[model samples]
Target: MSAAKPTIAVVDYGMGNLRSVTKALEHVADGRAHITLTAQPEVVRAADKVVFPGQGAMKDCMAGLLESGLKDAVLEAAANKPFFGVCVGAQLLLDHSEEGDTPALGLYAGQVKRFPDGLSDAAGARLKVPHMGWNEVWQTARHPLFAGVADGSRFYFVHSYYMAPADAALSLGYAEYPFAFSAVIGRDNVFATQFHPEKSAAAGLKLLENFIAWDGQR
Candidate 1:
């Protein structure tokens, strides 16, 4: 008998680029996974896994979640189901953000702040906001998210702010600007990536496949 397919809810918080994410997930899972793009809280709460994908300012994304009444549902989902966040969506899992002085979901104990001034040298060659385009993800620690994926894999990135989790042990991937910052994070069932895995090509697809196949017991 075939194994039961897991239902994944791609959260629609009015801030994410939903179509591309949905399309990429569909392709990787080969139609075996049920991907639902929804704003409904119950759908999120009921799903086997929840993906929080967004691209926008932190303030706007938080406000959208509250306005949609999905905040409570997300918290509940995180308590039980496997939760994944991408880009701005990943940053929201922290306690607060320096961006707009916004408070976050507080699922993880940490703060998100702007890249420090020292990140660049006197020449100012590396320090640029919204770090765009393809960059390499250096594996810092092994996690289920990195299963079937190797080190030095390049992923697409486009963001200014980055995450600094209090527990550095949760960090799975790091990227260099003038300094290194968290790229992929995995703590228990909560996983997030600062890069756009959906846009990262084959490596990205493999990461999604790993997430879908994740048993979530570890």
Candidate 2:
């Protein structure tokens, strides 16, 4: 008998850019899995895998999750299933964010911080606050998610604040924005990225494929 198809839930808490995230997952699923964009708490609880993708302010995102009653569902998935977080979804896993001084889900250790004011690159040219465009992401640890991704493969990025995990051991990848910052992180059944793998083209797709196949044991 064929194995049951895994249901991957893309949580819809009303804050993130969900269209691209949902479409990207669908494309990568390729009949190997079922992807659902759900706002219902029960549906999230039942899924085999969860993709928590978010875009915009940390305060609003947390508010939406709380009002929708999806926070607990997300916490349950993180503790018990193959969970993936993208962008702000990744940030929410941390203890808190400096953005509006928002409190996070506290799933991951450490705090989210904004890029310091008066920052400049090596050339002394002021770096943009919202770090945009494509940048090289260096794999810092071994995990199934980066099976085919090269060590210094470039990925798409769009964020201003970054998460600074208290434990460096949680980091899986780092990218340099004229300096080093974490780009990927994983712990137990959970994995997350500051860069959008969906927007990352070939390398990103490979990572998604790996996630789809991963059994979450690691």
The local distance difference test score of each candidate is: 0.86, 0.90
Clashing pairs in 1: none
Please report, as a residue range, the 10-residue window in candidate 2 with the lowest summed lDDT.
1-10
In model 2, the Cα lDDT at residue 212 comes to 84
| C-alpha-based local distance difference test score of model 1 | 0.86
Question: What are the per-residue Cα lDDT tens digits for candidate 2 across 71-152?
Answer: 9999999999899999999999999999999999999788888877787888899888799989998888888888988999
Q: Which candidate number maximizes lDDT? A: 2
